[model samples]
Target chain A: MTVSLDLSDVTAHYGNTKVLEDLSLHVAEGELVSLLGASGCGKTTTLRLVAGFLEPTSGRIKLGETDLTRLPAHSRDIGLVFQTYALFPHLSVRDNVAFGLKQRGEGRAARQRKADEMIERVGLAGFADRFQANLSGGQRQRVALARALVIEPRLLMFDEPLSNLDAKLRVDMRVEIRRLQQINGTTALYVTHDQEEAFSISDRVAIMNAGRIMQLDTPEVLYSRPANLFVADFVGFENVIPMRAVAEAGDAVRAEIEGGGMIDLPKQHYTVPAQEFVLASRPEGLLVDTADRTDGLPAKLGLRTYLGRAYQYQCDTTAGPVKANGPLGTPREEGEIVTLIPQPEQCCLLPREAK
Target chain B: MQRRAHPALIAFAVLTFLFLIGPLVIIVGAALSDTSYLTFPPQGLTLHWFQNVFEISAFKRTMITSFQLAVGGTALSMAIGIPAAYAMARYRIELPRFLGNVFVLPILVPEIVLGFSLMKSVAVGSGVPIMGALLLGHALLVLPYCVRVVGASLNSFDFSIEEAAVSLGCPRWKAFFTVVLPNVKPGIIAGFILAFITSLNDVSISIFLTGPGVSTLPIQLLAHMEQFFDPTIASVSVLLMFVTVAVMAIVERTLGLTFLTK
Candidate 1:
């Protein structure tokens, strides 16, 4: 049966070192939510806490209405797919898949039947009798997935499960995992350091830093309107320039870049921060205006990199070093003077960063 | 370019090899001597001394007792040390480095001193039976190998697989039995074999603890040497040397000899 996972104000530590600090999350039933962050950003710790491997120093974890704060992992009815696949090397595919059933006292004949059915479903029908040592990397992961899913656990968790797969296989395997989870309608929490993987697979993504989640929202909103500079920067916002509002009209806002430029943006396209704010954009969003010093921030180009679709310019601005995309049709040479125009459609105005 | 050794260095290396393996070659050769007494060169080859080891009824009983102690002691050491090593390897204990050092500390004590201490504490002072006391001593003597070898195996194991079992609805301890135990089988078997050999060949510990009727095979061999200097003991040693080599080869094939270093 499916159950929602709720982690409320959980704080955890390793001896004196704090890992997750008063973190709270609620994953809706049948929904897949991803915890996205760099390595050691406490994403794995959060998954471990949910799986009942690590107890929280404070607060509670709930699966549906069940209080799981002190539940052992096996009793929690949660499945975890590790990056290593973690398949039992000694057991054949059938036995490995049937292990959970056997432990819960399922009869031998019954469990074997169920395990065989699952082996076939995961595309390893004839290979059930083969040992893990005989399987390829993809086949091994498929076994791991089938073993976790066959239990029909209340919640399924993935800890960078696709990180070990090559790029092409990673895409295919993620699709496979997502298909099975959908067929079962099990709530899942996925932890990954890859932004693309999270954005593509999850219904919503939580970007974490240190121990706190900076923002949790749909991938679209997180990409377009991140709540703060950190979240903005995490979603490919390469330039963050502080700006003060000079004037405002009904559908337009005129702002002055901190250094030496003026810009006008559509009011509906970007958030008008109540006070002085920071403007963030991706390299593609921060386009180099061909004009030298009009309608944008003044910059001097340092280095140019030819991206397949565009030539990216590393330009020095009074704000800091800024990377912006210049049109390949009219490439800018190094040491050339340029101006940067921020496209509100690809930009967001964030409140000052919280310390 | 490979460097060449000097003439003096080559001569010194040859002497060292002879010094190390010289006694073993002499014993193997003497075991085949036609003469009844144990003598090396100038003797016609015969297999009579090899057959003599199987003739003595007293020697048979001692061999039985020695085999029993080796099997029983190795079993007890594994029963205690596998779980203990698992704890030391898998969990974060207080002063883990210090605890690891203490776990393998039994090997640091001289075998003779350990034997005397065992006899004093277990047999005489503690009022234990002779066979029980000897078994306990052997188990204690081989515990370090059990811990070291099994601990090395457990250390290199991917603990995540254990967690995977736990996640798959296996109880924590049951997970250890089904998952952890089977994966580290090579190390466990290697450890058991090593401990078995140590118990089988133990002399100093057996000497201190042997009462009237409870001497081990090695103690009986020592007694036989005192009565007659025959090639019978040499034949037994050769057989044991071959057994030890076979066991070592099996361990090397299965777990790789580098596990000992681990």
Candidate 2:
């Protein structure tokens, strides 16, 4: 049976440099949670901490009510798949899959039987006796997945598991890993720098920056409604319009852009602070309006490029440069005076962060 | 496109190989000679010297002593060197450069000079027995190669495998045996064979260390040569070469000797 994992206020360091600062996360039973971030953002470090390679300086880590912070890696009973597919080079595929069983003092016949079953499940029926050296990269990935799953570990972890494969094989292996993890119903934590890889396979994705989770949500919510400026920018929000709330009108609030223009937004659509805030929008959310429009944020079109289904424009505004998309039928020319409007469905309002 | 070997390069390689093996060929030829003295071209073919090599009481006695020294020295060096090499390569020890340089210091000193120093310190000054002295000296002599070869392998080893083992329910200590040791098997075999051969063929160190009624085979053979310069010495040399070649062949067949170059 699988179990949930919880880390309460975990803080970790590499010597004097603090990599994680009182961070916490939880993965529910049989659920997949991905730690998605750039390098050095502590995603891999978080996985290592859960795997018992690094003990938190001050925190309580629990796996299904069993405290794991003080336990050694071997006693933690977690399965980890490395980026390099760290299979034992000297052992056969079946033997490598059975290594955990062997270490747990299982008889040879029992280990061999279970290992062979796992090998066949990963679609490596004929490769039971073959060593990792002879296997292809994709085949080796399957072997790694089988080995980690064979022990029925409480939690399974993957550190950039598909980074070594080619583009095609990476997608295939990603599906295989997700399917295998689901079929076994094991709680798992995945760490990856690839956003698409994370979003496609994870039940929830935690976007990380500077060792902290900026936002934790499902792919749909994260794609449409980013919680803050950092996550909005990460999820492809190109323009951040700084604004100040001026007044409230019935069920809507009136806010003025920092440089010019004012607009009313439904109060239910945004939660802005009392003073300053940000209007974060994807390129498609901010539309290039007709020249001479009255209720549009002021801008001067600098360049225009065709984007297959739409035309993207570079607009110079009073606050900063902005990239926005306009309809393909009406392409704006360079140096044309234009106005930009925000579409509420593709845009979000976030509170200005305290530095 | 097909590639062709340059004529001059081919000739150079042939000349270099012949230069290396010419002396060995002559020695083997002389080993089967029917002669009173060591000679390259034999007057006739005979196996008398091979039979004579078995009859010498000193040869039999010294052979056993030499065998003991080789096996004991190799075992002692490997037992110490494997862990020492692993620690140096894997750990963030203080002054890593200094520790590496210190382990390799014995090899830098001339063999005869080191042997003389050890003889004075371990044999005469300390009153240790001659066999004990020889065993200790031989172990010291081969320790450097064992550390060096195994250390090279450990340096390039993907230590993530060891971590994987630990994460897979194997204890840290057992991870070394089940994962690290098996992965670095080539280096261990290379180190062991190098130590064994060096200890067996060593003469300079044995000269200063051997005492009354206790001498290594090479030292004993040298004393025999002074009295009778014969084909029997050539036969003994051939036998030593055979053993070395056989050991190397087994290594080549098993894990391959490519790691030797590495």
Q: Tens digits of per-residue lDDT for model 2 on A204-305?
A: 999998888989999889999998888889899989888888888788788888877776777776677657888889989889987676445788998888
Global local distance difference test of model 1: 0.89
Measured by lDDT, the strongest candidate is: 2
lDDT of 1 by residue, B1-262 (tens): 9999999999999999999999999999999999989898729998898788889876888989998999998898888999889988888454457888876767898999999999899999989999999889999989999998988889889999999999988888888888999999888998998998999999999999999987888899999999989999998888778878888898899878777666
Q: Supply the global lDDT for candidate 2.
A: 0.89
Which residue pairs clash within candidate 1? none
Candidate with best DockQ: 1
A6-74 per-residue lDDT for model 1 (tens digits): 989999998898999999999999999999999889999999998889899999999999999999888
Clashes of 2: 0
Question: A325 in model 1: Cα distance from truth in Å?
Answer: 2.3
